[model samples]
Target: MRTVAARTTALAAVVTAIGLLPWLSGKDPALSVLRARSAEQEATEEALTAIRDDLGLGSGPVALLGRWADGVVHGDLGVSWVSGTDVLPSVISGLGVSLGLMGASLAVALLLAAALSTATLVRGARGTLRGGAATGGAPAAMLASVPEFLLATVLLIALGVWLGWLPTSGWQGPSSLVLPALAMGVPAGGLLGRLVDDALPAVFGERWVGLWRTSGVTSRRIAFAALRRAVPAIVPQFGLVAVGLTGGAVAVETVFAVPGIGRAALGAAKAQDLPMIQGAVLVLLVLGLTAGALAHLVRVRLLGPGLRDAALALPSPPRMRAGRVARAVPVVLAGVLLVVIGWGLLRDPFTVEATARLAAPSWAHPMGTDGLGRDVLARLGHGAASTVGVALAVCLISYLFALTIGFLPAFSAGVADIANALPPVIAGILVAAVLGPGTVGASVAVALISWPPLAAHASALVQETRAAGFLTAQQAIGSTPRRILTRHILPAVAGPVARHAVLRLPGIALALASLGFLGLGAQPPAPEWGLLLDESRAYVERAPWAALAPAAALALLAGFAVSLSAWAGAGPRGAAAPAKAVS
Candidate 1:
């Protein structure tokens, strides 16, 4: 009870702090409002001062927070500067749409996870359970690696363009939900499936399972029992997956033109609407925290206190070695990327072919032509460098930042945690609003947002490694702290850090793509994948190949990054390895 009370108090404090972020950021809210209204720059200083005073910007933080909290408790969410309407109603309407999408996606993910788990668990005696689990897990890992936008693009092309099976965009009926849900759910499902697979074997190995088997329990009954026991352990993980999916929905909603909170947030961010941005972020934070709390309660209720701890303490499953095909995947992907970049550099990607506008695949143009008669293949080839380059840059910068600050003490660690809690999309929007849109803005945004989680992970590992026996021995021998870190700790943590860097590439790529799609990255005439998709949206039906080509390239690149990470042994097994062993 005391713990719960402490947590509640902490949550309230954090939420209050978050609510004050916009004011504390040092951004001029009056200027933001004026910009939204497109007010003339020559407007007198008197006008600015009047606007600021009207908004009560002169008030102290405590007073402002108290007023905001009072209004919130009375069901008010302030008024939007852009729309001139009460924020609560619009937020509520947007929340309903987002909730529907999230709920559907969550249900689909859980079902898919269950099905995948069952398939792996029911493998025949002829196959080794380890091999079966690995085989089953590989697909999910690959899926999880693919960014949501890339997945959404591919599904849009395959189902909407090629097969004509579903609407390409918009939120009209049940059919529209299918593609978006799959896009959002598949990666999450893949992750959850792997979690279930890992937990089931441990549960089946319990002494109670042996007793049940000795007492003539059927195999089906035993499997059912194991699943029931495993679920509580998996529930907490589901919260994390849900949070990620919700964040990714910003891109998904944009791609599909869904009128959800994500879409509203994007618009609000673009317009620098402080009220809407604050309201959207607050709602999302509340939902994520509530879901996490509920999942914890469920776990405590279902497993009891002692068993839940035991389940969490179970040894992680064995690491599976990458097979021959897995090893060759990165090589093949790298070669293809090189070919595209080389081809792009040698030829003019912007050359027009007015005579063959909207042309299908042929000897003249392999990937056909867009509405503007530009070769899709050439555009994709050129875009490859920008897409892949931004991803690489973000990954390198973020990793370097992580390594540098992550080795620092608790102050840096606390800052990292706070930064990590800010969603990447929101960060990108804020950066773009301040810096103005371009590759530089997008890259900086992504790197800033991506570094926090990596820093937190690396810091924890460094702290753990510092406490190991070898480090202690070095310290006892009068070794300098710098030398100890450089010679011993650095090498110990390098593998995990490298793995994290690789794993983070796909997400960085997705973030860049999302920004580009929103016109905040790689401005006009630049062959960026997201920009290409954005430009081609109006002509999708007329020249589907233009969008399809870049979408496929992005998907392939994301997949390759994922495969490379997996091949490097950066999966759950590697992450869960003991720090003592590394030392």
Candidate 2:
């Protein structure tokens, strides 16, 4: 009861702080607008003349405030700042589109993650390659390192241009959701994969599972039942990932030119349209808070106390008997393939004319030109570099920040929990607003926003790992906590951290690309995948390939990242205590 009381107090305090932000930010603009009104009133003779003339309401400022207050209190949401239409209608319509997109994307991502996790878990002890190499976590981490725009860009081009299926940009029908949904789902899917990868192994290794199997429970039944039990553990991570998806939605909305709140906010920010900005932010804040609360409720209800414990347990797989050479060959081949692909793509951009014209079905400009007429091949090549580069950069930067934030609490548990509570979204928005828009701004935003979960995971890991035998032994031998952590704990925790990074990478990439595509990041002539798609906006009807190229690129890159993350690392250790080892 006391703990609940304390937690409630903390939540209230956080809410108060968040509510205060707009008022503080509004002061400058309010003062400027009001001061101008004062001057106008002085210049004129009427009591409310200046207010009416300047604000277009023919009413006093106090009257406007009264109306706003009444509407807000009653949940009316008031009128649109631009069209003077009912704000509730606008919000409803826009939310419908946005929610539809979000809902579909979430569904697809969850499904894909579940499937991949099931596949990996079913692979079992024979899963080991040469040197008893760990699998899923490594790929998940790698994929998490890549960005979303790259996936979207690559897929858009391949599907729209090569396959003649799915429009590159803009909503034509239900199909319009496909590209954007893919963009959103790819990253979410990757994160889900990591969650499942972490969860399933523990389920496989349970001693009770073998006992159940001996008692006539089929292997499939054991796996399914264990998975059912693990669902509660997965919910909390899903909540964390959902936060990222919400932030990334702004970019996604802009890329497809969808009439969602995110795009509205982007327009408002660019125009410095105060009312619109305020309205959009209010909606987002409400939505975010609601989602977060629901997620928390779900986590508590489903996971209970053992939720975190289950997540940290490691599974002991049955030993593999595959020949060292055979295992080494697949790993080596995979590594070589990655190296070659990375090297080639990095060396030069992909160009339609140079790389695809003769081979592809001929049309005007054959493989087609981007907004700048750069070879699609070259643009794609560079786009791949940029897409993957930014994704990797965001993943690394965000993870590092998370690590720092997470560890700061090691010396004081209270401080760590407080740090965890600090809102990353608020920090990100403030930083982006101050820095102005661009790749740098987006990078900074991603770094700021992506840190919280990373911090949460890191804090949990550190708290647990600090007590492990190796750390105690090192301390007994006179090693510093830092030294012990750096040597033993860091190595052990690295794989899980990498998985987190993978799960996050695609979302960061998508956010950055959406910013670029919306003209918030890279501008024209930069050949960015998102920017490239943006440029083709005018040609949507004449040469849709122009837009499709970049979109495809973004999608493909995101998909690959998801795939890689699923194939990569091991589950979290210590953060969640596992069931006893299965013999």
Candidate number with greatest TM-score: 1
Model 2 lDDT per residue over 1-583, tens place = 3324434554454434333332434333333344433545333335445434655444534455555546656867544434546556666677778788889888878876766576555653332223323246444444443344445555565676568688776766898899878877766776677666766665656677667866886666766676766666666556545654565566667656778876676775554444555455566655654565676577566656766334433354443345555445435544543553454354344333344322321443434555434555556556656666876887898777666666675433433223333233333343344455567766675565555556667777777787777676777789986777678777666667667766556656665666666666765566676677777666555566666655555545445544433333223443332110000
TM-score of each: 0.86, 0.64
Stretches of candidate 2 above 4 Å error? 1-73, 76-86, 117-183, 218-223, 299-369, 374-404, 410-435, 453-511, 525-529, 540-583
lDDT of 1 by residue, 138-224 (tens): 676666666676677778777888898998788898898999998888877877887776666666555786688678877777777
TM-score of 2: 0.64
Report every candidate's CA lDDT.
0.71, 0.56
- In model 2, the worst 10-residue window by lDDT is 574-583
